[model samples]
Target: MVSERSSKEFFAVTLRVWRQAGPSASGRFVDYPATNVSPDMSFLELLDVVNDGLTVKDEEPIAFAHDCREGICGTCSCTINGKPHGPGHGIATCQLYMRSFKDGDTIIVEPFRARAFPLVKDLVTDRSAFDRIQQAGGFISVRTGAAPDANSIPVPKDDADLAMDAATCIGCGACVAACKNASAMLFVAAKVSHLGLMPQGQPERDKRVLAMVQAMDEAGFGNCTNQYECSAVCPKLITHDFIARMNRDYVKALFKAKFKPVSSASGGAG
Candidate 1:
């Protein structure tokens, strides 16, 4: 049921945004009043309005990240009122609207906090760590030749569906922000499973998981403690089950690597 009060044309709210001059500099929250805010305005639009006001007054505008404003890019990452992507379910920050709040409400906005995602500026953090992890092994190698037909490979319906679900992760780093231990397992699991579930990924399955996991730990991300907060705040609503699947695959890979037989030059087991 829609509330009548939330449908009003415009309202006002206070934005308490964290302002940091640099990664090493001290930071604090500064309050800015947003007046006559339309209920239809997206959260990023609200920031733009506040920035316009600051520009008119010759003051520095708040720093934040945004792109494609349609919730697909996942570039507009921020914690609104202590919730990733703000007061919404299965939507990114760019999808959040001013109507979610009441007039005169105080909204606390901050950047995603995690050691792996270093602070770049106010409301923006360095997420290149994700790129690094992906580069470690999130791919399959195929010989260069004529493109294979779409139906050349037969994939089970269930596996294809699950692969697509895992592929929906936009690498936003929200999982790390939402986790109490700041873990990145959810993101890694999604990457691993989306490819691991497919026949094309079998050749490098064991190597991929091993390399990515090592890279994740090398990047200083914490391990998952099974709290499941990562899935709760996910904009795509990806289930935590992927994490378990990855764990099983990892164990199997380790066992296979340890016990695989070694053939002798004489064509007999060593």
Candidate 2:
């Protein structure tokens, strides 16, 4: 039997953290008490306070990644209390406020887990998996010459408008985390659509989409089921229309390659 006075004297916050010492090690959730918290602190700052407490006690501090804490860099990514990139919708964990939570909240902090994002350390995973996909041809090859005049090629307003929306992706893996299948379709499509829509990208647009999509599959990412969850949590609001655009470009490339009978006879399938 607990008294009301006892409850008033004690306010406890439970935190379950996914702790792993190294890449090969098995991880488990370690509980810690969130004490002396002020509701005004940002979620990452609260974690910093908890880490400070641990350091004071000669304990190992939680190893999480953060830089340019202003939230523009997307370096500080964490799934908080079961939500990818934290409690506030369409924002990173660093932007989430402790005030949005209650006095005695059960906060669960974990890294974005997927086969592609192997755990590198406690609360940090290797996100370079995304870089590999990008390197596989997410960009246009620059010509070693002066820039073409902007007015030389006029793009339709509707196409240009949609391309801008797709180009805003920050390359954050929030889309992957939000997807049930851990798909990187949203990320790949955004890059593909952004480049493919521009006139300068025409020279290598077909090859770019094929290469990036191949790389995405090789990275062990799942297929997009068109759930639209990727767009829902995207900070930049990148659209699924980009994914459709990528698909169309890929199909057009296939048809173009197949119908070129002389080249098709001389060369193996790409």
* Tens-digit per-residue lDDT, 1-270, candidate 1: 344555557899999999998999999999999999988888899999999999999998998989988878879889999888888999999988888888899999999999999998899999999999999999999989999999899999999999999999998888999999889999999999999999999999999998899999999999899999999999999999999999999999989988989766786565
Clashes of each: 0, 0
lDDT of 2: 0.82
List CA RMSD, all candidates.
Answer: 2.8, 6.1
Candidate 2 regions exceeding 4 Å error are: 1-12, 145-157, 261-270
The C-alpha TM-scores of every prediction are 0.95, 0.87
Model 1 misplaced stretches (Cα beyond 4 Å)? 1-8, 263-270
Question: For residues 1-270, what per-residue lDDT tens digits would candidate 2 score against the true structure?
Answer: 222232234345777899999999998999988976656567788789889989999988998878777667878878787667776766777777666666678889898878898889888888898999889987777777988877898888887887788878877788898899999999999998888888867898888888899999999999999999888878777888888888899899878867865643666665
